[model samples]
Target chain A: MIVGVMGPEGSYSEKAAKLWMQKYSMSGSELRYFADIEDAFLATVQGKSDISIIPIENSIEGSVGVTLDLLLENEAKIVGEIVVRIEHCLLSKGGPEKVRVILSHPQGLAQCRHFLKKHFPDAELRSTGSTSHAARLAGEFEEMAAIASPEAAECYGLKVLLSNIQDKKENYTRFIVLKAGKKTLTEPETGSEKCSSSACKTSLIVYLEKDRPGALYEILGTFAKRKINLTKIESRPSKKELGDYYFYIDFEGHDSDALVKDALKDIKAKTDTLKILGSYPAFKTFRSVNIDKGY
Target chain B: MIVGVMGPEGSYSEKAAKLWMQKYSMSGSELRYFADIEDAFLATVQGKSDISIIPIENSIEGSVGVTLDLLLENEAKIVGEIVVRIEHCLLSKGGPEKVRVILSHPQGLAQCRHFLKKHFPDAELRSTGSTSHAARLAGEFEEMAAIASPEAAECYGLKVLLSNIQDKKENYTRFIVLKAGKKTLTEPETGSEKCSSSACKTSLIVYLEKDRPGALYEILGTFAKRKINLTKIESRPSKKELGDYYFYIDFEGHDSDALVKDALKDIKAKTDTLKILGSYPAFKTFRSVNIDKGY
Candidate 1:
């Protein structure tokens, strides 16, 4: 099996991929890295990689717009999810006094704003393509430091200058695993299942038939009447015009389930467009090291 | 009157402030620039500025998480809104061939990714606090170019090397004007109006009384039954734990309106916490320069 993620390597996406593998007791999977989230998804669709793990949202930053947009545009099916706590660390080759420049992915740098403001007030902050790439740069430059995962520090032979540097301690990111396939409206066959799990979730993108008052409320009513729990709801611009949006919703049931199917049917009747992104198993807790801990 | 905004004088926030001033036909308002959005909001809360124009959401990028988070934490009230189209330009002191480094706010750089990849694939990309700040640095460095607004080129004495470099053409950002005040549930008195508008919108942060199934669906039922249109709905992590979230919602209608008031009453009765961000006039279209048009 091959897993695709945004790279160089040692990024949070990789960490989530590893956690996903461990949780499912899967081994011998090769990890492939791409330059961007869309590229990772594309790799899966093109059969270059079997699956792609991509960050969908973050606790502090909210949704990853690119991932959401790409999901809407691509044919990949979400097969699983994993939530990883983000712990940013300041990694460097030299001590704090020796560092004059800081490098990181933009989000990584923003997460450690307060720590950097107080300690590296004079350092020049630069954005890189990925945290691991920043780590590589930090390792190569004596006067440069990087804000990244501890795994990145170890991979690049860098020392942790500061740990748990993010402003919010409870920061977490939700990642979704995507496979290239058309999602079926029916549930998977239980007896001859290639991959199946209990506790399923169904994701959908619903567009209103018309721009009318209470349209969304009526749609939510479909699920509410059936006592279905919605895990997430977010509005994304349709890119056609202002005020036009495509609602992304995640609910707690597989499409094959009777209750879920009825609700989706009602929603389809009311909505102008309804696309089921996929139904996959809900995320369960898994054990992983504190990423903030220094190597 | 004084208006605070994130700036180096040519940011989209500054443009929105200018547009707001023009729409209200107000004059003699000093526009003050801050290094960050929070500082601009703080200026209003601390009485340093009468109002602050802050970007609430972008069509392509979605909500500005920091702005939403800060509004929830502070006592600022939304008073007005303005939408500005984002147009990115590649500005530099030297020609495109001489540019070795590109700088801009992370969003600006991301928006122009396609342009950069096609034209300057080898150039190093860096993130800055503001697009105008990137323009300033680009002006100072002969080998550096900035992906910024055309206004920044004029302000920083840089030449526009390329225009309309963003990947998307319909990119627009919505900015809200905030004041330091608590919103009253009652409708504003028309005769003794200190501030009032005809078409209004009320924004709120709603927290469920408990994590019950269909809790959100029930809440939407309140608005749905009232035939109220929800402009937006998003769930932000409550920072308490996983699955716990605070729903940020914007709906058409003033809190003073009878139907809106009744919906709020019902929502408050069922919610654990309900905070009214404020009621303000719905956004109206305004004429502004196309950002992609080169100087």
Candidate 2:
């Protein structure tokens, strides 16, 4: 199986794709690198790769809204998902004392803000294309250090002077593997037989009629009256006019479920546009808050 | 009057604050600068300045979420507001022919992404603390251009190699003049009397009760039924649990209006905690958009 990831040779997405290949596939498995998650999805759709892993959300920074926007606009379906626990480390060429500057992705630098504030507040902080790039840069320039993964440090032949330096210990990224059409992996609990049970999530994008009174309420009430628990609801501007919006919602039931089907019908009646983005496993295990370190 | 703005020196906030001082009743103004908007707010709350000018939102980037977060957390009240049209220029000392690198704030660079992609796709881009800082660096270097305001070019003695270089011509930033307590401003159109009419937009921060189901929808239903137009709603982590959130909402219409008052009453009954942040004029002006020059 070929896996698609984001890269310019060495990115976190590349590392993630490699990890997946090692854990679940063959040693000589094919790997494809796209400039962005969108390109990766397109490649998967065009049969370039079997699946593409795209980051959906992060703990500290919240949702990667761009990914959600792309998913809403695209036709790919999420087949499976994974959550990687991120452990950011400060890697230098020789040691911590030799470091006069630090470089990493802006998000990486922000994630480790508290550590930098308390320890290296005076050091010039620079941003690079990726954590891996930062690690590579630090290896080339002895005066520079990088905030990146332990795996990156190892790959770049760097020494980790600090570990788990992120501001929040619960920092994790949820990645979804997308395919052209629907497919299901075996349930984690029961791997004995081929079960026809569907996934438990119904993700949708809804655009309400302009200034329609009670439109949002009417759409949400359908789920409320049916005892459906909404896992998420985020609004983005339709980018057409002021106050115009499209809501992205995730509810706790399959689209085929009677209640969810009824709710969608109700929402369709009330909204100008409704797009069922996808229905897939909730991945509750992958979303558990992990706090293995202190601030 | 003493005005506080975000800067070490020569930031966009400084220019915005100066414009505000010139336009308003600050006949003899004392200007102060802070490193960030949060610091500006604190200085205002602590009586360091009569008012602080802070950028609340940008057209391309949406709201400056940090500014909004600080406003929610701080003690200062917004007294007046303004919008500044932003037109970024590429300033260089080495001429466009010699320029090989571009530098500016990440947001500034992001706003000019389309322009950069078209003209300087190969130019190495870097992030600086502010556009003015980038200008300063460009003044001392060769083969580099600073993406900043023309005002910054004047301040730093850099020549504008490319003016109106931003992707969107209608780029604008909404700035709020903050004070320690609410003070009514004289109506620009009718200076005869103090405008005592309640603010048209009502702002609220709400927290839902634990184990609540459909609480947000039930509360929002109140406004939906009353035909109130919610301008925006953003969810911030309550920092208590994995999925719990505190929602910040803005809706059109005065809270004193019968329908709005009734809606709030119903909402208060359902929400675990709800605070009226404040209400003010919508500030419906396109001062930041349709600019004729690169400022």
TM-score of each: 0.91, 0.82
- Candidate 2 chain B worst ten-residue window by lDDT: B185-194
List candidate 1 segments past 4 Å from native: A117-123, A187-198, A285-295, B117-122, B187-198, B285-295
Q: Give me candidate 1's TM-score against the actual structure.
A: 0.91
Return the top candidate by TM-score. 1
Model 2 C-alpha lDDT per residue in residues A66-144, reported as the tens digit of each score:
5766676666776555556678899988777778888876667766765876797667667565677778778888888
**B1-295 in candidate 1: lDDT tens per residue?**
8989988888888888887776666677899998767678889999989899998877666677778878888888887777888888999999888999999977787677668778977788887777888898899888999998999999999999988888778787788889887776774622112333236678999987334878887888898887887888877767566566788998888887778889999998987689898877777423343333211
lDDT of 2 by residue, B92-177 (tens): 98778888888886667766866876798667676665677778778888798988888888888889898888766667676777
Residue A273's lDDT within candidate 2 is 76
* Reference-based lDDT, residue A25, model 1: 64
